[model samples]
Target: MTHPFGFNYGGKTHYFVFDSESGSLHNVDYVTFLCVKNRLSIPFEGGEAEDFRALEKEEIDEINAELDQLASQGVLDSPCTVTQKKKRTGEIKALCLHICHDCNLRCRYCFADEGTYRTADKAHMPVEVGLRAVDFLIANSGKRKSLEIDFFGGEPLMNMTTVKAVVEYARSLEASTGKTFSFTMTTNCLLLNEENRKWLNDNMYNVVLSIDGRREIHNAVRKTPSGADAFDVILNNALEFRKIRGDKSYYVRGTFTAKNLDFCNDVLYLNDCGFDQISMEPVVTDLPDLQIKKEHLPVIFKEYEKLAAAYIDRRKNKDTWFNFFHFMYDLEGGPCVVKRLTGCGSGCEYLAVTPRGDIYPCHQFAERKPYKMGNVLQGVSYDRNVSDVFAGNIVTNKPDCTDCPAKYYCSGGCVANNLNFAGDMNKPYDISCAMMRKRFELSLAIAAIEACEG
Candidate 1:
């Protein structure tokens, strides 16, 4: 009973359960649901045993089948070989380089706190630092034949020269080192033009174009330092970039703040604009205006429903698709088989290097000492105590997550998010937890539908 969790939906309260123990998802009718509920409420001793014997044979058989399945899934405290949590067995597989600490656009809901993290003057990462970051990733990638390098920043495109230099140097190392490199760049599209498009098309593995959906939505929050609108420029660059990017190695990444609760149209808007791969995420912040409010949850849910329908419509039409969270789910397990109890590769397999070569656990923790791992030049020589603390942050260490059915799938929530909202890395973000629950419910339903159809 501990692992099989689900929700009732549609008319007459049809019940669906996700059996996490065996990774099985199935539905139970009203009578079966009631029988299971009643039996769990009472101990099967003297009184409960008599009550159970009074039930009809068919009902008892149905209830017994449910119990057997639940027992098989280890829900009834049945003894079984517990799946142990895994540590990183591989080397550094991915690294995010904060190529610049300054951005040209003045996006209102920027989690980077308007580029400088609201602390100091803006600066760009020099070529030397970027090159060292590339080297650091290569050197520390141990035994892993392939590595992913992400060029992140206040605006990665602002330091085009540094990006080009790093890519070229990385490519130069590939032949001799015999390591395959997958390069990605995240940009606001404010700086994209003919030359930049050509360079990205030629060298980059993929470009994440940051545009907040429709023209009005994009202009409302995402703007230039001079208060100029970003919609026109972003659209223009995306069109040109897409022309050379016929293979579709790019994703239109957007953000939806509290203001844009009904943002489903934005996905359709991007689709109409000829962009297929799209990701629209709710803005993660505690700021009043930007944060997703409780009232906005329903609207967001509806929006996701609409987006899912649109995705199905696209598939039917033999057209492109807007890849969203539900699109990532399969009956086998949402995305991938997560061996570790943790949700992400923050401090273990991935490292985030700041402009000055300051190393952090991940991109969100960049410039923050609390999550600092090591500098690029010095390598990821983490402090013993800090390393131990992060190592213990898996689901087994988190009391709340230990009982959660979605623990294996949710990346145990983001460390940076926890530290930001609750002032502690071990603390959880309750808001995001609700969001994850809704997402899991939707994903489970999609998985059920697909399973039935197939």
Candidate 2:
């Protein structure tokens, strides 16, 4: 099933466009490639590729010209040497700043507590450090153009001083660089109060509160330092904040553990609470959480499907839309990018700054010392081991996924997760593959039903 150029497509082939000059391979799906193919041809000039439709003659010519350029550089054979190049729109134009390492609540699933998680000696980042990070971002903003900075935490508000500094700094940077800047925070919401809410409102900051659904489910997993229920205060603050914002963009992030598999009621409950967006992520850790056993996963998947289907139907029928995941799923042309492909911009394009000034690929990879891409002070440096691990698993092919039909879509799964748990990043991402296949199939089914009805 090899395409004319050298792209061998079987079930396992996750399509990627390799820039031989940059040594970077981009993960693009086949559908997107087909769309790209229909849009472009060679021998054209002067216009952004993005503005041109795939079916337009001039756009087609421009695409062919780009392909010819690649071919001249020995990257492709001719204008039609490879499948259509994936469009890198950079839609998720945001950066997550791990501003604080000290958290007030201690969840058992806290990746920070994971033995692999590393931090700088200090638990807080100074205002100057944040300013420098903003500087770095502003300098690189030309490449990305529009970008947003997100304040992430052990509890970001724990050091409100730094948060304020970074926000102000980003604004100043934007003023000087002419780059648009926005702010968001992912927090436990335990420390939020009227004063903080006012500050957030003044700054137009979006807040994503971490709450695990209802009282019992939330209290069971999230707790205060004194082991008391933390939801009461969080809910109160969220209500207060909502009153101030008068918008539905504020979100509640719910994490699902094995224990809460039977918690579909919580989804309805969140909707009743006037929340428009709700995020659900499975509890993933270095060591497999027993709650996410093979048998339990199907149940979890079924629960997600039930909740998502109901939520979508409600939204379509002019019922209240309560689910954030559904909105994210529908907005993107397909399923969530993370759920579909291997490797993200986490390391290469995106870097996470810890409170102590150390940088890692992401929060999850921060815990793993080997995955630390570099430090802020020293600048960006790619570790060969890290690159090799990623290249072997994601950038290159593997024996298990080499011949599989779904390889292109899954991209052999998460390199960091597979490397950490299975001691091999090159192995097949069987778990994620199964999950994505179900999601893709479900989405297609829903689309078909809608088409028939219309």
Candidate 3:
């Protein structure tokens, strides 16, 4: 019912319409915007309506007719639904390999249990294990010529030898197997020394550097085991890495929590740090003091608005511009219906391999024994019940998402988060859902401003 979202942004100089049904943004004049937004005759009256005083009845009627025509074309709030493609079966396209279940930093929000992943012994993935994982991806790829391998971990660089071996092995088979491999690594960058940074720049398709914003805020939660400041080292290394990386894809990723409700400043700080591509995510945790509650939504929403306004300013002034990951919405030719319906293809097309070679739905579900699909050595052999559950929990199948205004935009959100919060994959975490909806609105608004300004 909310397909066409109408709003005023950019200090109210821009009135825009976002057609979610078609993934289109339209920059509209005041009269037309008012017609679609009010869904009735004009509301202007008195001296405040002076600018529109000369608009004849016939002009108003004509604008109404145009709006009606747009609605019928599914570029407005059309009743028609997008057809969901049949559920995908076996064709793994991406793998997150846990290179090591160990890390150098002791981040307070470390979900991997300070690098052990809840395991007693922090272990580095054996070189053979990493090689086997590459082979496993190649063998089960099923016509997927371009495959993705993300070297993930408590810290992937901890197992540099294994990572290099896997990449080399995967590359060795490219010509013979008629397949190509792209690599991505997510690291804290403490180990991004000269040699390692050079090698990563040459091989990785993308690199994710972890740093919280502002020195004080970052050092508050993220530090070395010896309780020393970890921010400076990581920041310096990230800058160095970016200098040599040329134009390849990389982002400085940060996390916001209850401690940092005023997170907009952190985002701006990252932008000022010379990292052009950036992502700032809310921390997902069960720790009561750190959890984002309903009361925090208003503050968070306000921060988002501040960010959006800054985004608009940056877009207009190119010198201070940076890409905020959450706001990067492709309004033209987005993913197909199947991709939208199935979310990230976590348990299906994408799976994570732990340091021990065990496969799980994704990295977040790595140590959870019940979700284990199988191991790289044996291939995917596990309970059909788990697979069926994953296949059935598409956006269309999720009761909560079926009628949501942002269903197609978010695709039912993160499955792991849903499971952890709502205790069901089909049920979304309300906090995340709210944040996502607000982000979608702001993203559309930002796009609308750009479209109009251009």
Candidate 1 residue pairs that clash: 1-75, 343-411
lDDT string for model 3 (1-454, tens) is 4333444455564556666656656667777765664563436544426655566789879988987787777777656376563357577789999999999999888878887889988889999889888888887789999999999999999899999999999999999999999999999999999999999999999999998898988999888999999888899999999889877999899999888998989999888877789899999887787778889999999899888888778766666888999997776667887778777888777889998899888898899999988888776454445656687768777778765667888988898899889998889999999999888878877776676566
Against the correct fold, how does model 1 do in TM-score?
A: 0.86
> Higher-TM-score candidate among 2 and 3?
3
Each candidate's number of clashing pairs is 2, 19, 0
Candidate 3 runs further than 4 Å off? 3-10, 29-63, 379-385
| C-alpha RMSD between model 2 and the true structure | 12.3
**In terms of lDDT, which candidate is strongest?**
3
The window of 10 residues in a row where model 1 has the poorest summed lDDT is 1-10
Deviation from native of the Cα of residue 1 in model 1, angstroms: 6.3
317 Cα displacement, candidate 1 (Å): 2.1
Worst 10 residues of 2 by lDDT: 1-10
- Tens digit per residue, CA lDDT, model 1, 270-318: 8888887788878897779889877778788777766655665574453
lDDT of 2 by residue, 333-447 (tens): 5444433333454553455676656666666666466676555555434353543434334423466754333344445666666665567766644555565555544443344
TM-score of 2: 0.70
Using all chains and alpha carbons, the TM-scores for the candidates as numbered come to 0.86, 0.70, 0.91
Report per-prediction Cα RMSD to one decimal. Answer: 4.7, 12.3, 3.5
